[model samples]
Each structure stands twice: as structure tokens, then as C-alpha cells.
Target: MTGLAIAFLILSITIVWGGLVASILFLRSRPEPAEYPPGGVDDHREDIGPAERDT
Candidate 1:
């Protein structure tokens, strides 16, 4: 029974550790703000200057 308890404890610890590592990796792999520039079709056009819109 002790062996089973130890094995379960190890598995729980491993799962928690794996979750933490995965979260860190995901955060690290996130794209920077510069990676995706602004101004898609749905973006606010009113904010742009009149000269820019004329171009």
C-alpha cells in the first residue's frame, strides 16, 4: 500500500511539474507585439488622418 501511495505521489508531482513547464514554454513562445502589425480591414478608420485616407 505504501508503494502505491508513493507511486501516486510521484505521478501527481510529475503532472504538476509538467503543467508548469508547459505554461512557461507557452508564455516564452508567444509572439511579440511587433510580430503582427496593426491596420487590418476591421480596424478603426476614423483615427487615421485625412491625408492618409486620401492616399
Candidate 2:
């Protein structure tokens, strides 16, 4: 492959793999919340206050 093509290939691969590694590290450090809010999908907005919600 030409030099520019090789450079772009390397750049794309680095971006994809770098994002995967960064996300794994970030999630490992902060982790997801253990406890979800009381409501399931339909009523998941229970945590929002009435004044802030649209009618």
C-alpha cells in the first residue's frame, strides 16, 4: 500500500482500539450503579420532579 494509505489505516485502527481501551478503563474505575431507581421502563421517569417534566 502507499504511504498515505498505510498511515490512514494505522490511524483508524488506533482510534478504534484506543476508544475500546479507554472505555474499558473508564467503566472499570467508575462502574455502573448497583441500585437502579424503583420504576421499570414505562415509569422510569419517577425520579424527575413534576415541575421539570413536560405535560
Candidate 3:
């Protein structure tokens, strides 16, 4: 392949790989999922105000 084609292919692969890595890191940095007990209620976080609950 020509130099331009090879460069373009490499750049495309790099961009896609970078986006995947960024997505994984972003998701990993987020808070963990809520743990719900068998009672059917979620263990809410302190950040959630009382008004927000059961609404």
C-alpha cells in the first residue's frame, strides 16, 4: 500500500482504540452500582435527598 494509505489506516486504528480506552476509563472512574437488598429497595446514597426517595 501507499504511504498515505498506511498512515491513514494506522491513524484510524489509533483513534478507534483511543476511543475504546477512553470509554473504559470513563466508565471505570464512575461510582459503583447500587446494591439492592431482597426487600426490593435500593440502598440509596447520602447524596440523594429525602424528597428524591420514593418519588
Candidate 3 or 1, higher lDDT: 3
Question: Which candidate number would show the highest TM-score if scored against the true structure?
Answer: 2
The full ranking of all candidates by lDDT, starting with the best, is 2, 3, 1
The digit string of per-residue lDDT tens for model 3 on 1-55 reads 9999999999999999999999999889975656656534565565655555464
Give lDDT tens digits, candidate 2, residues 1-55. Answer: 9999999999999999999999999999989666666564455576676466566
- Per-prediction TM-score: 0.53, 0.60, 0.55
Residue pairs with backbone overlap in model 2: none
TM-score, predicted candidate 1 vs. hidden true structure: 0.53
**Residue 52 of candidate 1: its Cα lDDT?**
47
The TM-score obtained by model 2 is 0.60
- Model 2 residue 2 distance off true place after TM-score fit, in angstroms: 0.2
RMSD of each: 8.9, 6.5, 8.9
Per-residue lDDT of candidate 1, residues 36-55 (tens digit): 34665555687776554454
